[model samples]
Target: MYKCFLEIGFEAELSTHEDPELLELAHEMCNEDVATRHIACAELRDMIYERGECNPYRMDDVFLLRFLRARDFIVPKAHRLLVRWCNFRIQYPYLYEGVDLWALVKIKDAYEGTLLDRPDIGRLSIFRFGTWDTSEFPVEDLVKAGVLMFDIGIRQPKLQVLGGTLIVDLEGITLRHVATLTPTIAYQIVSLLGVTTPARLKSCHIINYSWILNTFFYLFKRFIPREFYDKIFFHGYDLKSLQKHIDLECLPPRYGGTCNSHAPFGLWLQKIKKYRTAEFDKEMKALGYLVKE
Candidate 1:
C-alpha cells in the first residue's frame, strides 16, 4: 500500500529518508526539537488526563504529536484542540458511525476523488460541489462522509507531516446547492477545518465560482477563521490563476493539466480499503467508528 501504513506510535525517532524536509518542517513550524518533543507530548497527555472530561482520546506520543504540530507545539493550544475534537466526537457521533466509503462514493452528490500524484505539500483531494444533488443526498450524509475522509487522512504520517490540500470546483453551484449549507452547517464546516481537525490544511483552492457562491460566502464568511480565510483562494474559473498556487503538473487534464485522467471512483475505494489495517481499524474503533470486520 503506502510505503508504510501509519507508523505505530512509540519511541521511534524520525526517519532521515522518508521525507527529510519533514524534519525541518517539524522543527521550524512545529517548534519540534527532537530532544524536547517527548516532553511536549507528555505534557499534553498530562493535561488531557488532568481534565478528566475528554473521552475516547489517545494519549500516545504520535497521536498527541498530530495535535501539537497542528498548533505549533503549543501545549495548551494542542490540549484545547484535542479537547474540542473529543467534544466534536461526543457531540456528533453519527458522523463516525458506520461510514461506508463504498456507499458514500456511490452517492453522486458526494463524489471525492484523489489526485494520483502526492505533492510535497501533501495528498490532494478534489470535490465538485456541482455534482451534489440535495434532493437525493442529505447534507448531513455528505458531512458524515467528509469527516471519515479527514479521519483516515489524518492518521497517516505523510499527511500529518506535509499536510493536505483541497481543490473545490464549483462549476455548477446554484441556489439549491447553496441552500444546503445552512448557517449551522456552515459554522460546523468552518470550525472543523479551521480548528477541530488535527490535520494541517495547507491550502484550499476554490475555482469556477459564481455569484451564488459569492453571496453564500458573504453571508457566512464571519464563521471562518481569519487565518484560514487567508489560505483560501478564489480562482473564478481561471485554471491559470490556480496554476500559480498548484503546479499544472499536479492537476488533471480537466483542469488544464497533464495527468492521464482521473481514476475511477471504485479504484480509489479499493486503494483506501488498503489503509484499513488491523491497528488502524482498532484506533478508529476506539474513536467510535463502526469498522466492518
Candidate 2:
C-alpha cells in the first residue's frame, strides 16, 4: 500500500487510524458500495448472535429497531410499532422468515389494521411487528385481518415553511439530501422498499408524519453514506439560501438558473448498466457501483 501511494504521489503518510478524511475520498475503490455496503451491519449481526453462534448473518428484522433506536426514535407511537415487530419475529419465526427481501411492503397493509392498532400492543407490539421498515409478514387483506382508524393522517408542511423544514420544489425528484417534503411520511416509503429504512425527519406535521417517518427512516442512511461531505445536498431553487446553504454546481437560482443543476438522487446508479450514456459506457463494463464522492 505504501509503495502504491508513493507511486501516486500522495503526501499524507499512511497511518494506523483511517480517520473519516482518509477513508472517504470521492474516488472509486474495491468491491464496496450500497449493494455491498455492510460494515455496521455485520457488526450488529455479530453482536446479536455472537458471530459464530448463528452465522451472524447479513440482515434480519431486528436491525431496523437497532438503527432507529440509535437516535432515540421519533415518537412513542413509532416505538410502539417497533416493539410489536420484535416479538412477532420471535413468536412466529417461520411466519416472519417468508419475507421477500426485494419487494416493498404494502405500506397500508404491512402496518395498517392489525394488532399494531391496539394501544394495548404498545412498544411491545412494534417489537412484535418489528422495527424493520417492512415486516417479514406483508400486511394482510381486510378479509383475513381486521382493522380500525383507517384514514389517520398528518398535515403537509406549508410552502412558506420550506426553508424551515428545507423542502425543495424540484423540476423532478431524483435524489438530494435537503427536501421540504412533509418528512413524516418516511415510514410509508420504507415499508414499500422492504429493505433499508430512514430516521425520523423533524417536522411539524403530526397527524401523518409519524406514519411516514417510522416507515422510511432506515433508507436515510443509504442517502447519507459514510462520507458526510458528499451528503451535503440542498434545494437548487432556494436562491436566498443558495449562497448561504445550497451550492449548485450548474444551475443558478429561479427558472433562469443553471441547467443540469440536479443533485444526485435515487440509488447511486453510477454504474453504466441502465444509464448507457457516454459517461457510464466504461463503468458498466466494471460491473460495480462506484463511490461518486
Candidate 3:
C-alpha cells in the first residue's frame, strides 16, 4: 500500500471515502507486480520518447499509470490517448504557456467561475460556473480559459485520481450567450473536455437552465459524442434536483448552500491563482515552450 503511494509520489493522503474500485485498480496496476510494472512503464516511456511526444519531460511510472487506468490497462489504447493529450498541448500553446495572475484573472472573468476547494462525496473537484459576459470576450478565449482550468486540475493527484464535477449556473444567461454556442466552438469544448484533457468527468449539472437554453443545448449536444450525453444533467431552477447530485453544503450561497455568505468565487480564484501560477511557469520551462505576450 505504501509502496503504491510512493511509486506515484502521491503526497496527499487518500480520502477515507475513496472509491474501492479505483483503489483496487491502482493497487492492481502499481502494487501487484513490481517487475512487470517497471517493464511495462519502460516500454510505454520508450514509445512516447521515440515519437518525440515527451522528450525532456519523460513519462514516469505514476504518470503512465494514469494513462493505463484511463484505458483499462490496455497499452495500445492508452498510448493513443496519451499521444492525443500531447498533441492538444502542442497545438494550443496559448492555454499552457506563461500563465500568471493577469492571464488567470482574464480567464476567470471570461468564464466567470472557479474550482471550489471542497469536492463531492466521490472526491471529485467541483467547478462552479457563473454567468459569463459573452459580449466581453471572443469564444476562443473562453475555450482557452476552460482548457487552462483543466491543466490546473490534472496537476492535482486527488482530482486526477477521482475526477471532476461541473456545476453550470445559468441564472443571468441571455439569448446572446446561447447564440455563441456555434457548432465549431461546441465541438472544441466537447472534444477538449471529453477526449484531450487528462481529467475524468464525473458529472455536469446545468442549473437554472431556461427554455431557450434547452434549444441551444439540443443543438450543442449534436457536437458531443452520444456517450457524454448521459453525464450531463439539466436541472432547470431546481435546487433540490441539483442537490441530489452535489451536496448543498459544498455549494456557495447563491446556489442555496451554506458554505459561504455569498458566492465564494474570489476565494476559489485566489486559491487557484496562488497554487498554479508558478507550476505553470515550470511546466512551460520544462517543455522549452513559451507563450507570446
Candidate 4:
C-alpha cells in the first residue's frame, strides 16, 4: 500500500505498519532473510540463556528481532548487544527504576527534545539544549526522560528497520550546561545509546553549536564509536548546511524551513502511547520500574 518508498532516494512514509516494500528493503539492507531469521532468533535466545543472566529479558522473537536487525542480523553480535543492554540496565537503575510514563510530562512540557512532525529518510528528532533550564530540570532527569523516549520509540517496527535521525541544537548553550555533562554522565549517555541500545541511528546533525558546546562534544567524542563518529555532522548555526541533508520544506520554521505547524512533544507521546504493550509493562515491572495502571 505504501508506494513512495520504492525509489532509491525517496523519503520513507512513516507509519506504524511495515508494508512488503519495507520488508524487502530490510532483506536487502539489513540481511533479514526469511529462512535464516527464524534460526538466528532461536540461536540468540539460546546464547542469552547460556550466559546465566539472572535478569528477566523478553526472549520472544518480537523483542529479539530488534537486536538482530540492529546488528545486521548477525546472531553473535546481536547476542552481545542483548547482554550489554541487560548489563546497562543493572548498572544504571536511576535512569530506569521508578520512571513513570506520565510523570515525564514536566520534561516533555519543557519541549527541549521532540521528534519533528514530518519524517525525512528517518524520523527527525530535535534536542534543543538551549531551551533546557538546568536549575529546574536536572541533567539526570533529562537522561531519564531520554531513556523513556527511547524505550517508547523503539517499539515501532518502522523505526527499527528504517532507523532515525537526531538534531542536537546547541544554541545558547552555556558553560554551566557543559559542566552538567561531566565525564561520567557523558560516558553513560554515549554508552547507553551507542553501545547498548538496539535502535539504528542513521545520522546526527549538530546545529546552532558554539565553543561551549564544542567542549561538550569534545568530552562526548571519545566514547563515540568510529563508525558512529563518521555520521556526526557539525552545522554550527548554518541552517543551509543542515538543509543539504534535510530538505528545506520538511524542516520546521525554527530551522529556517516552511513547515510552520508542529506537534508538541506531549502530543507525540500521547500518539505513541498505544505502542506500549502489556508485555512492556511486565518487563518494566520486572526491572523494578513502577508502571502505574
Worst 10 residues of 1 by lDDT: 7-16
Checking candidate 3 for backbone clashes, the offending pairs are none
**Model 4 poorest ten-residue lDDT run:** 5-14
Give lDDT per model, in order.
0.68, 0.25, 0.57, 0.71
For model 2, give the 10-residue run with minimal summed lDDT: 151-160
Q: Which digits, one per residue and each the tens of the lDDT, describe model 2 over residues 138-206?
A: 333211111111100000011001101122232222222223222323323222121121222221111
Clash numbers, per candidate: 1, 52, 0, 0
Candidate 3's residue-wise lDDT over 1-293, tens digit each? 74553323222322223355546545543242434756767777777767765432447776676666555556766677788777766766665565442344554433433233333432333333334666666766677656655554455545555555666666666777777777766766776654665556667778775677766677667876677778889889988898788776666666676543221333444544343345455654565434323
Per-residue CA lDDT of model 1 for 39-140, tens digit only, reads: 999898888889876754567887888898888889999888888888877777777766655566654434454444353546566777677777877888
Clashing pairs in 4: none
The best candidate in terms of TM-score: 4
* Clashes (candidate 2): 52
lDDT of 3: 0.57
- The candidates, ranked best first by lDDT, are 4, 1, 3, 2
Q: Candidate 3: where is the Cα deviation over 4 Å?
A: 1-40, 46-58, 90-94, 97-101, 109-130, 261-280, 286-293
Deviation of model 4 at 169, angstroms: 0.3
